[model samples]
Target: VEISQILLHQCQQEGDETADVGPGGDYRARNKLLEHLITGDETWLHLSTAETKPESVTWKRRSSPVTKKFKVQKSATK
Candidate 1:
């Protein structure tokens, strides 16, 4: 299951700027894209170190509204 297509899809969905700066960084997005490419499903990829191979890459699934946490709530007590 090659995820290159999926990675590309996600990149398109996220737009170049957001995808580039998202969460961890460019490396994070690359790893995430790669995971989706390999698994054919959404997944996360963690880099063990700062070093990375030029060819290696990944991407993350477009976060959902719930996942993004658009709202804030105060604690309630009686």
Candidate 2:
């Protein structure tokens, strides 16, 4: 029971199906639930596979002794 508690129980069952709609419900099932909703920057969170400019090249050996190149950021909470 973990993928973040099944995505918080499917986002609390889609917030109780949008709080069961209202004022007499069913406008074609609320426009088929807002026409298949998909925004969050159109969604794509692969989360990992990054280094591939020749696997982030790093083959120094002409007296190899100079290391400190940390500057690759992307995640201010998505």
Candidate 3:
């Protein structure tokens, strides 16, 4: 629906009598203006992604058997 709308709009803007669905079986026109729009949109998307910071992960500590053994040995020596 969007592709058809775009094609129809562009065709109307260019004063065309009928709209063509482009060469590729899809409504994605090879029109320079539409191509610019697509690339510009992609550029904005990339910029937005690049400007954002990634989230940092939190770390947790786990209990270990080695620490328990060391504690037992230390208590015995004391």
What C-alpha lDDT do the candidate models reach, one value each? 0.48, 0.57, 0.47
lDDT computed for candidate 3: 0.47
TM-score for each model? 0.21, 0.23, 0.21
Better of 2 and 3 by lDDT: 2
Top candidate by lDDT: 2
For model 2, residues 1-78, the per-residue Cα lDDT tens digits are: 586676666665665343344577744333333446555665444454468789777889989888786876654333
Model 3 agreement with the true structure over 1-78: per-residue lDDT tens digits? 998798778856865334457668666334545444643333222222122233433344666333221222222211
Candidate 1 lDDT tens digits, 1-78: 466676677767765342355565643333444444443455555433333656344455667333352344444432
Top TM-score prediction, candidate number: 2
**Could you tell me which residue pairs clash in candidate 1?**
3-37, 30-57, 30-58, 31-58, 32-58, 32-59, 33-58, 33-59, 34-58
CA displacement after TM-score superposition, residue 22 of candidate 3 (Å): 24
Instruction: Compare candidates 1 and 3 on lDDT and give the better one.
Output: 1
Q: Which stretch of 10 consecutive residues in model 1 shows the poorest summed lDDT?
A: 64-73
